[model samples]
Target: MSPARAATSVVDVVAAALRERILDGDLPPGERLVEGALAADHDVARHTVRAALRVLAAERLVVVEPHRGARVAALEAGDVTALYELRTALEVEAAHLALSRHEGRLPPAVHEAAASLAARCRVGDPRWVRVSEAHTDLHAAIVRASGARRIIEAHGALAQETRLFLLRIRPHLGYARLASEHEELVADLERVGPRALRAHLRASAAVLVDQLA
Candidate 1:
C-alpha cells in the first residue's frame, strides 16, 4: 500500500477505536486523555495518537485544551441540542427523500437491528447502553439509504455528539420510551409515508431536548 494510504489507515483505526470507547462511556465526558498512554494501549506512536486525536477534535468529539491537552468533549446542553437538531433536520429530509425515490420496504437488516435494540432497551443500564448504540446505527442507516454521502456524514457526527449527552447524563430516556419511539419511527416510516417520518423525527428531537432540560 502507498505510504499515504498506510498513514490514513492508522489514523482511521485510532479514531474508530476511540470513537467506540467514547460512545459506550468507556471514555466518559470530561475525562482526561493521556496521549502517550493511549499510544501504548493502541500500539501506535505518540504522534499517531495525537494525529488521531486531532481528527476527533476537529469533529468536536474531543476537546483540546491549551496546556492541559485533550479530554473527552464536555457534554453541554446547548451543544447537545444543536447536534440533535441538525440530525433531526438531515434525517427528516433523508426519510422523506427515501420514500419519494424508493418503492417500498425497510431494509431487513435494518429492521432486525432495530428490533434487537428495542428488546435490549427494556433491560439494565449496560443493556440500555448497547441499545443506544443500535438506536444510533438504525437511524443512521435510514439516512445512509438516502444515498446522500454529505448528509450521512453530517448526521453521523451529530449522532456521535448526541451519544455524549446520553452517556454523561444517563438521561431518563429509559426503555419503554426508547423502544416505543423506535418502533413508532419504523411504523411511521412504513405508514403515512414521508410526512409522518419527518414529524416523528422532529418529535424525537424535541423529546431529547426535553429530557436534557
Candidate 2:
C-alpha cells in the first residue's frame, strides 16, 4: 500500500476503536483524550492519533478544542431535543413513504430488526451496547424502507450521535420497555401509519431530556 493509504487505514482503525470506547461508555463524556496517551496505547504516531481524533470530531463523537485537545462529546438537554426532532422528521417521513410506496406494508427488514431488538432484550442480562445496537438497527431499517436514497443517507449521518444519546439514557429506558415499545411501533407502522413513529420518537426525546434535567 502507498504511505498515504497505509496512514489513512491506521487512522480509521484508531478512530473506530476510540469511537467504540466512547459509545460503550468506557470513555465517559468530558473525558480528555490525550493524544500522546492514545498514540502510545494504539502504538501509532502522535500525528496518526491526531488524525483519528479529527475524524471522530467530524462525526461529532469528539470535541476538539484549540489547545485543550479532544474529549468525548456530551449531549446536553437541548442537543437531545434537537437530535430527536430531526430524527422524528426523517423517520416519520420514511414511514409514510414506506407505507405508500409498498402498499401499506413495511419491508421485511423492519420486522427482522424488530425481532433482533426483542432478542437482544431477552438476554438473561442484557448488555446496554447490544441493546442500543439493536435499537439503532430497527430505526435504520425503518428509514431504509423508504426507498429514498437521500433520506437513507441523512439518517445514516445521525447514527453515531444517536448511539451516544442512547448510551446516556439506556439506564432509564429498561430493556423490556424498549423492546416492547419498538415491537408495538413496528406493528403500528403497518396498521396506523407514521403517527406511531412520531409519537415514539417524541416520547423517547422527552425521556432523554427529562433525565438530563
Candidate 3:
C-alpha cells in the first residue's frame, strides 16, 4: 500500500483501539482524552491521535469542545433514560420479529450468548467489562436473529452505550443477580415468548435508570 493508505489504516486501527477502551470502561465517562499522551502511548503522531479522537467524537463516544479538547461522553441521567427507552423499543421489536420468523424459538446463538453471560457472572467478581460485553452479546444475538440487517446496524452503537451503562450499574446489581437474570432471560425466550421478553427488558431498563437517578 501507498504511504497515505498506510497512514489511514493506522488511524483506523488507533481509533478502533481507543473506542474499545472507552466502551470497556477503561476510559470512563468524563475522562479527558489527551492527544499527546495517546500518540506517545500508541507510538503515533499527534495528528493521527487527533484523527482518532475525531472518529470517536462522530460516534458520540467522545465529546470534543472548542477549548477543552476531547473527553469520554458524560451521559446525563436524561441521556441514559432516552437511550434505554429507544433500546427497549428496538429490542422488543427485534424479539417479536425473531420469534415470528423462527417459530417462537430463538436462534442457538442467543442461547450460547446467555450461557456465556452466566459463566462470566459465575466468576468471582468478574470484570465489569467482560460482564458488560456478555450482556451486549446476548442482546445482539437476539437482534441478529430478527433477520434485519438495518436493525442490527442501528443497534451497534446503542449496544456499546448499554454496555457502558451496565458497567456503571454493576456495583449495585451484583454478579449473582445478573447471572440469575440472564438464566431467566434465556428460559423466558425459549418458553414464555416475546411478551415476557419485553417485560424483562423494560424491567431491566428501569432498574438501570433508577441507579442513574
| Number of the top TM-score candidate | 2
Using TM-score as the measure, name the better of candidate 2 and candidate 3: 2
TM-score list, all predictions: 0.77, 0.95, 0.88
Candidate 3 total steric clashes = 0
Candidate 1 residue-wise lDDT, 1-213, digit = tens: 999999889989999899888877788778888999999999998988999999888778899988898999975557766765676688878877666666755666557777877778866554545766877788877887777888888888676666665665456566777788778878778777666766765565565566557
- Best model number under lDDT: 2
- Look at candidate 2 and give me any clashing residue pairs: none
Please report how far candidate 3 places residue 194 from its true position, in Å: 2.2
- Report the alpha-carbon TM-score of model 2 versus the true structure: 0.95
Model 3 over residues 1-213: C-alpha lDDT tens digits?
999999999999999899788876789889999989999999999999999888888777889998999999877778777877788778878888999998888888998998999999898767767778888899899999998888888888686667667766766678889888877887887687777777876676677667668
For all candidates in order, the CA lDDT equals 0.76, 0.91, 0.83
* Lowest lDDT block of 10, candidate 2: 126-135
Model 1, 191: alpha-carbon shift in Å? Answer: 2.6
Candidate 2: tens digits of C-alpha lDDT, residues 138-196: 99999999999999999999998999988888777788888998999999989899999
From the highest lDDT down, the ranking of the candidates is 2, 3, 1
lDDT of 3 at 71: 95
- Provide the global lDDT of candidate 2 against the true structure: 0.91
